[model samples]
Target chain A: MSIGIDELEDLAVGAAFLGTGGGGDPYIGRLIATKAIQDCGEPTVLDLDQVKDDDFVVTVAGYGAPTVQIEKLIGEGELEKALAKLEQHLKKKVTAIIPAEIGGSNSLVPIALASRCKLPVINADGMGRAFPELPMNVFSFNGISASPMIVTDEHCNTAIVETASDRTAEKITRAIAIELGLRVFIGCYPMTGRMVRECAIEGTLSQAIAIGRSIRQRPPGSCAIESLMHCLSTIYPDRESRVLFTGKIVDVQRDTADGFSKGSFRIEAFGSGQSAELIFQNEFLRVCVEDKLVAVVPDLICVVDEETASPITTGALRYGQRVKVIGIEAPPQLCSEQALTYVGPECFGMDFPYKSIATLEAEAADKAPKSATAV
Target chain B: MSIGIDELEDLAVGAAFLGTGGGGDPYIGRLIATKAIQDCGEPTVLDLDQVKDDDFVVTVAGYGAPTVQIEKLIGEGELEKALAKLEQHLKKKVTAIIPAEIGGSNSLVPIALASRCKLPVINADGMGRAFPELPMNVFSFNGISASPMIVTDEHCNTAIVETASDRTAEKITRAIAIELGLRVFIGCYPMTGRMVRECAIEGTLSQAIAIGRSIRQRPPGSCAIESLMHCLSTIYPDRESRVLFTGKIVDVQRDTADGFSKGSFRIEAFGSGQSAELIFQNEFLRVCVEDKLVAVVPDLICVVDEETASPITTGALRYGQRVKVIGIEAPPQLCSEQALTYVGPECFGMDFPYKSIATLEAEAADKAPKSATAV
Candidate 1:
């Protein structure tokens, strides 16, 4: 399969919806990928089964404050430059590219770079959804080294980090990204095709495109919520998807600290006089209704425009915006005991235990007819 | 010549004196070098004239807050680990190691690593005396690239920085050092023996040892200052050395900020009613007597114990301690127009123009009979 210029819009929309209000805004990414495809032809999307065991595959993404990406536009050829540097360091040609995360701008980053470099992009990603830190990805969770990672800026300055552990790599890379104007392109997790097949979240790029196409086919204000939820459930049969709340944003408190956008938002039910709160650090980590924990990571909590069905990132959220909150169960691999220990709510300093969206919904049903249940 | 365990003490003392209150304390470095030499025979010290043009040489130094060096001691084999990583990156064997700066701990770092790795220590350094920032070194001022620089911490984490400009390399490296507990070991400025001979301050290591021997040979408190000055003048004929003041420290205001010990010290003359002030950032940068500029960077301003002629670093300074202030002319290359722009008073944010110590001394002589002229 090849992703041509015509499909970029759908990819961006799907990626944005999957971003869970993190991964940064995808509009610019869409434009960049579109232009790259137009200039260099469509990028080939290689299925996992097609990858040779010995082929070299690398994940590429932009890391920094999403807010900065809006104003400090990336220069042309930045991604190519970063990928070239990484190839030089490894002294091996890259056979394929993959997104570190299949969310927002990160999803399009690989596609753009692939078109420019004429390398196929693997139809999978390290993270099924957006994550703020480097170690939160599936590859790192599976013990794949993030070392020999290359971080490059628009100015062409490059730094290659080789750390003993993934946590150390994250610390050093994050610090360097912050130092380099809070935005840097990173080429990391250079693994063989066999490792990619074993560690990656399979078919995420195609899943995102399918999800976007499903949402786009529905009328803007007519049963859009139901249609979107139906598409998610059909695409991820094992994962639960449902609307958590429909309300108007009442208040928002956010601040960029420690190289992350950290804060919370409150949403009031349109006519019920009830409110829900969502806490976040780069991505929405937890959602609560009337002080009751309804959802937490690694479950996805996405905020979207109630009327237009367009996903809104945390950086783009504003008070008084009417929105629909939704939660989707994470992939089974991500919720396993070992993976949860690293990406669970506790990792973000939350004291509560992890609970699936399905469990939370069942508990809400048990308290039906009450003034305000969790869901 | 060889530097056995017997010579480590003298090397530390001389290096500390040359540190000008920066480059960290050398006591730990001496111990490390002594142990390494004791374990693996004496390390060879190669003269610049003996180096072949094609020989690969690298400067080794510890960069971070001097205060941290005292409390968070380095683990054994840390320097060797960093050197091994750099060699792996360059894909070639390093023929010899040189000190990045002939100051405090940095001066002995090469000796310690060289002894453990069985490589010769070059009798030269990038900076004749320590300066806080990386670009202040003669290698950078002379247009040598600081690229492919390796930064390693106690945890065995390493990062290799390659940048278009030396300033960018320093900025990124400094930020990483701050992130890694305010100290990191750096192997940078990989150059050929020919480049080292052309840009390095040759024989600095031996000069430091001779200076240490001169001070060590002096009786407890008899004219040690004059003897030390004589040794310095004889070693650096183009440079002038003189006593600027002999006084008790009345006040010392120091704080560690931006990974540097920055502050000022006030010295009141023992018998006269005159006082002088010294401002420093890692190293003593400027001095004024009665509010008149006496000396400024890139000239050397050193503070030492008034009685023992022992160099006292900024981190060890205490109020009410009697000290001797001495000034030595910087090497002519360092004081040239090109170098001064990066290491001069202006670079330190001082508004005054740079004046040679010779010129300042002549002005002070013409103002004799005045109550308080700049020394």
Candidate 2:
């Protein structure tokens, strides 16, 4: 389906809602996407099955510390700069653009690229949630390389990297980010539609839109606990979604180093007379409720306002604000030992082993395992 | 004098010593400079007035937070990235290179550029003593524009900017740095030898080398207090210099924002039952001794280790370091209202009016002023 002018905001909002709070802010992304869509005209989304086996699809996103972007706004035409160069290199019309990850600002980045290039945006993403490193994506876990990658920044600085190994891409990307200045607009991960379709998380855009709409139309005075659980139930039916303690943010300790937002937050529990803390490297990976480890790495921990049910982007969450913390099961694909190696609690300085969100919840329940639910 | 392999180490050492702790660590910078010298042959210094009026010149330096550079070392040839692009853009062979600033890593940045381009280096700079902002430089203050600048990062992101205003150039350059990821290499300030002669600080390189050598050759048990005063007295025989206090740092606070280091520091007085505090934005502008304002801005308030005679760059002066703080009369040119308006104590966040460093020193002497008596 092709996007219309009015649908841009909806799509951008949806994308940001699903960003799970680690993407850079979506305002710049939205403006650029809107402008690109206006310039190239509204584009359509191509189905994975419709794309040929060899069709080349490139994933694009901004790389660098998010803190810098707020101080120094991006220059014009940087996104299209790398895109134009990539197209020139390929000498082929890009059939579609795909979101590499669903986090704060990047969720909308691919949509913007697709709208600007007048190409369809694939319905899938490499990560079901946000991650700090490049190779942590599902595609990389599936043995797909991140190289032959063309990365660029707003200054029109570009690099065509052909790495010896996919792991090298992370180092190269980090170095490039450091050299470029810690924040850059980048385009990478060129893959065929078939490879992407098999590796990517499908229908994330629709999922994000639905989540955004749910929050937007949330009933007044209704606890986000029920609405979010209802939404999760729509996505995962068997397990009963539990409402974690409601609390006010007491502190948000953040340090942007080595191209990642490495920090944690503490929340003083209000009604429950308990405190909650979450630790993260790019995305919320662990949550501790009342000094008990309620959730661990490989689980998806999200924080939002209790009243509004609106998702809080990681960077936007600050102290003295009331929020409702929620935890959900990460897709089984991300629970592997390899996946845990890069994004697990250990990677975030947690002195604990990886525990699936489902397993953690079931352990908390102290009951028989329920039927497996498909997402 | 040409920089040969024989003197590159000495030069690099001298450059780092002169950097006064702010240009970043000289390890990687020395490597790059040495490699460039080895690769492109020795670079010779050219006197500005000696060049023809039509001779092309450019300034080269790294543009970004120094912290970013330390975390991710610049890639090979990163310094030449912007220079190469600028050379291509102008279609004119750059005959010489000059340093835009002479503090921190910037003091040595030109060595790499000049060696790589096989260009003669100019012995002058925009600032005899470094000021944080681009417009505060002598070149900019003297009506030389910073536009037509080319900025790039190791990622090969290149930006060619020409602005009507120098402030716009600063903004754009900073934005591009942010885009390149916060660490960028820049080649800028394209000007003719005539402009260079008119606006540049002549013999700054020689000055730094002399100052560095003197600091290094201090006699045993000789305080930096005597050595620095001797050096400055020799350099500026016409100017007055006074040691305000000899003490160790007790408290230091700083914020690196808007491309300037703005902060304050306090120290416990060496002998008296008192303390001293100084406030600054880029340069040491104010000093208060025992809650009494002792010195003000448009003056030079340099702090150095009492024993080592090593000058302390503002950002590098930390707690527990014994230092001898000196107050020197600024040059007549720098004592003007224009200079004070740009760098006075008020500009940094003090509530006092400008006071001449000489007059302040006279008041502090509590004795008869010496008249043209060389120490």
Candidate 3:
């Protein structure tokens, strides 16, 4: 299937929903991808089954502070430059492009470059949802090397990192990004089609498009929260999707530290004394109501505009904005023991044990407090 | 010519003096070079005149914080691994290895690697005296690109930086160094033999060896300060060398901040009402008597043990130690208008105009009270 300019808009909306307040703002990415599709022809996007076993696949993503992305926008051709450099280092032609994460800017970066380079993009991604760290991707958790990664900036400066560990590569890449204007294009995880099929979160691109289309097709006067939850449930039948809270943003405390936008926000329920708080480092990692855990990653904690169902990124969050908090079960692959070791709440220095959204909700219902179980 | 174990010691001693308190303590480098020579046979040492114009040359040095180098020593074969990677990138045999800076550890790093890699050691360096930043090197000032620079650490991780400017390269390399244990082996400024001959500070290896030999040849009870002065004058006849002050270190205030050891030391004249203070960042940059600027970079301010004339790096400074402050004129190349734009005192944030050591001493002589002239 070809991804045209119209498809890019849908992809952006879907990516923002999946981003869960990370992955960076997608507005610029959508514009860039739209322009790229217009300048070049629509890019071919191949299903996982269509990829040859021997084909070489690479993942492309934007790495930097989301706050910085709003102002220091990437110029056209930057992603292509990064991909070209990676191909040169690998000494092989890249048969296809893939998103490192299915969120915000990262989701569209691959399509933008693939269109310009006339390469097909794989209809899959390393992360089913947005993640703040490189290692949080399935490719890294499944033993794919992040090495021979090429990072390029708008100024045409490039750096190739070959590290012994994925974590080290992330560290070095983040440091370089900070040095090069706080944002860079990264092409990494060069895997064979077989490896991609084995480890990738398959069909995330189509799923995102479906989600975007569903949200857009909602009728006027329909409850956005109910429509989005129904859309998510229809698309991901095996996973639980629910609106965890509905409130107005009361407070947002943020600081850009250690190359990450880290902060917490509080939401106060309308006509009720109840309030919820979400803490994040790039992506929303945890949400609690009255100091009791309601949802935690790798489960999704999505904040969206109540009226329009448009996702709001962490960088875009502000006080007094009415929003709905939605929680979706993460893919089983992400919740695996090995994956949780790196992506779990412990990784973020939280002492609380990880429990699924369903389990937390079940316990809340069993407690026999009507107001507490209202979510 | 070949550099043996004996020559390695001399090189280390001389390099320490030339380090002006920055290149990190050479004790470990000397030990490593000595062991490498014993195992691999002495490496060939080639003079600039001996190199053919077409021969490929690369500079190798250790980039890191001096305080860290004392404890987190490199494992064997690290430098060789870095050079091998660089050669692989350049797709050509490195005819000779040169020091990026003629500083304590950096000066010997090339020789140590050359001994094992079977490459000739070039009798030259990019920096005649160690400076804090990579752009302060003569090669950079003379328009050599510091691109495709490879940085490797003990863990075998390597990063290749191709930048549009040398300053960017330095910023990225330094950032990577911080990520990779605050110390790394950097192979940069790949050039032809002709480029080295045109831009490199030639004969620095031989000059260091000569200085080392002279310091060693001093009689046990002879006046070390006077003898060292005579040795320097005899060696660098065109340059001015003098003891700037003779006093006891009264105070030392230092802090390791931003990957640099920065602070100042105060010295009180022996049995007199006189004192001087020297400020440094890795390398000593300025010296003042009662807040009056006496000597400043790109000139050299060296502090050595009063009794033995052993050079003390900024990291090893302590209070109440008897010491002598010596000033030497920087090479004319480094003092050139273009070179001074980045390496001069003002570049270090000092507002004062740069004046050569000779000029500073001349002004002091003209304004001298009888006691002040004693220096």
Candidate 4:
């Protein structure tokens, strides 16, 4: 429940740990958060209990091609462009700006805005981990629409859409990004602080900090992976984590379409006796063993560099790079028919049956789910 | 100024002629318009001058992937869904619905709703010919913004984006598409009859009908291109047209990102000792001769099957398919730095100097501008 200034760094690192590969580079995110904290002083962490249901809250994040942001470096005040419009659309004073998720650069984007906007940071996110779609947010799962959404790009171009359905808003956002040549910034999902508190994955920022701190404090020869495993065990005790593979990337192919990075990579065993190929659209959604489907979409598949333990994005996945692939059980909420139908195996074009991440983890865990129903 | 029911068919053909090969398939568009007319009777066509500036006119068209609409056909009540949101956003009665552009499909989309919604159809459009960006409408060039836009997909999903800027509205729309898995549907833009009249390419529906009729009524033994060229001469003697080359498609590559099918193609000359490479994003903008730039961006570069005379998209361009390359002048407004800069050669990664389609035509006519200072 408590997140300190120094812990922000740890949280980012840990969020990167949960990125499941392909959230985008976290360097800009870390630097931005660090700068915000140093300049604005530490941000006060607000607990869920403090937020009244009627208190206005806004969720902010960057929306665009990760590859483009790395080069263009969204101009200063770009996030503000969308925020300004959001304020106009809501016609209410915003009490806080919450990070939509904890992953890659997005983990830092909210920090950048909060430092400049003088808003408190919510210690929760819509997704417990990360997802490619806006509607996939836990807030949406909890019955909150992402409408009255404000989106913008660094060029100061902003849009505020009040859609009858969140899906329409999603289409509009995708189209505008395409029209802008595919890179944009966005502040969306304006809700009451109470709605955020009730719907969000609570205490995630604090959890991220703990996981990050544990990894950073670990001594040499102590596996960073083991530290993460230990930290997550405390927070997600019912769930299990498994080190899927340790290998060197052999090939990486990527395509950026409609603000999503769709691609795949092949990895050869470095020391282990196994090799694998991973496929994804924005996240490492599926993994295979020698062309045979092993673990599929909606199951968490993260690849971190073996040495630094940094998560690798699908776009950044390169040949000749050493990585440790990690698999973790997805939250039970993500296993609902609606959730699986969207981010599951069928959504990504696999004919295979839906299998829970717990099932995959069982192959590596000393003990596994009894019936494979635990996602 | 004079347009008949048969003229509408010709205009549809001509609009497709000017579409430069990247509007959604016109067949479905024609069918939709035809069916709407059959069911609801003819739409009342209003001229620009007939519409007052303050008149509530909304430009409507579909937003999302064309591929999806082709499969599902648009839902019957979807337009109503979009209109409901639009009416709320405008907070006024929509007196008329106008075509934003005379593209293959959208040119007729409004027709489907004309009688059902009891809204008059304006003969004008934002773009006389289709251009990808929403703001590319002449209305925008004339100081009208595309904000307060209404977008609806086939799923009865509707959204209203009322932003201070048109570009911001576009960004929101793009984000929505990205989130919705690239669903396609209708959208209304720049909600003022005056702006609609000024911005909507005037009499575009009439143009489409004329062109369609001309192509269908062409004399036998006259190929599609020759017949169309004759039609062009008759319709627009002020704008010169040239059959640049007759060749066969050798290669085609497409990248559908950001709602635009952008990329390039190569064609082998049939009898001429030359080959041409063309690049396009939404519309064919640049063409090169053996890697040396021949036609710059901002000018129209179109490819039609030599015998069939059907326009081919860069995505549909295939190897060994016989094609005829044609060049035409763009509107003077599109030739300006403000317009050309958006779709120019540099935007497409070409290093050629921007030459107006008029200037290019002038060169072919021995009337090329002799001095830079002279307009």
lDDT of 1 at A155: 88
What are the Cα lDDT values of the candidates? 0.87, 0.68, 0.87, 0.69
Tens-digit lDDT string for candidate 2 (B49-68): 67668878888776666546
Name the weakest run of 10 consecutive residues (lDDT summed) in model 1 chain A.
Answer: A366-375
Model 4 per-residue lDDT tens digits across residues B1-375: 533345456655566666776556566767777766667677777777788788887777765555444555767777767776667655678888787766666777777677567667787776666666666666666667676676656665555555556555655665665455555554556466655655455665665666566567778777676777887677667666678778888788877687666777888886766888887766677776776555665556677778877766554667889988877766565666776555556755666768765565456556445574354
Model 3 chain A: weakest 10-residue lDDT segment is: A217-226
Colliding residue pairs in candidate 3: none
lDDT tens string, model 3, A88-203? 77889999998999888889888888889999999999889999888888898899998889988999898999999999999999999989978888889999999998989889
lDDT of 1 by residue, A18-120 (tens): 8888887789889889889889988889988888899999999888888777777678888888888788789899999989997788899889899999999
| Cα misplacement distance, residue B342 of candidate 1 (Å) | 1.4
* Model 1 per-residue lDDT at B31: 76
Chain A TM-scores of each predicted structure, in the order given, are 0.96, 0.89, 0.97, 0.90
Model 2, range A198-270, lDDT digits (tens) per residue?
Answer: 8787766666666665666656766555765677779656433555658899999998887777788999977
Per-candidate interface C-alpha RMSD?
Answer: 1.2, 9.4, 0.7, 4.8
Superior by TM-score: candidate 1 or candidate 4:
1
Q: Which number leads on DockQ? A: 3
Restricted to chain B, the TM-score per model reads 0.96, 0.85, 0.96, 0.86
Name model 1 segments beyond 4 Å from true. A219-222, A363-375, B219-221, B271-274, B361-375
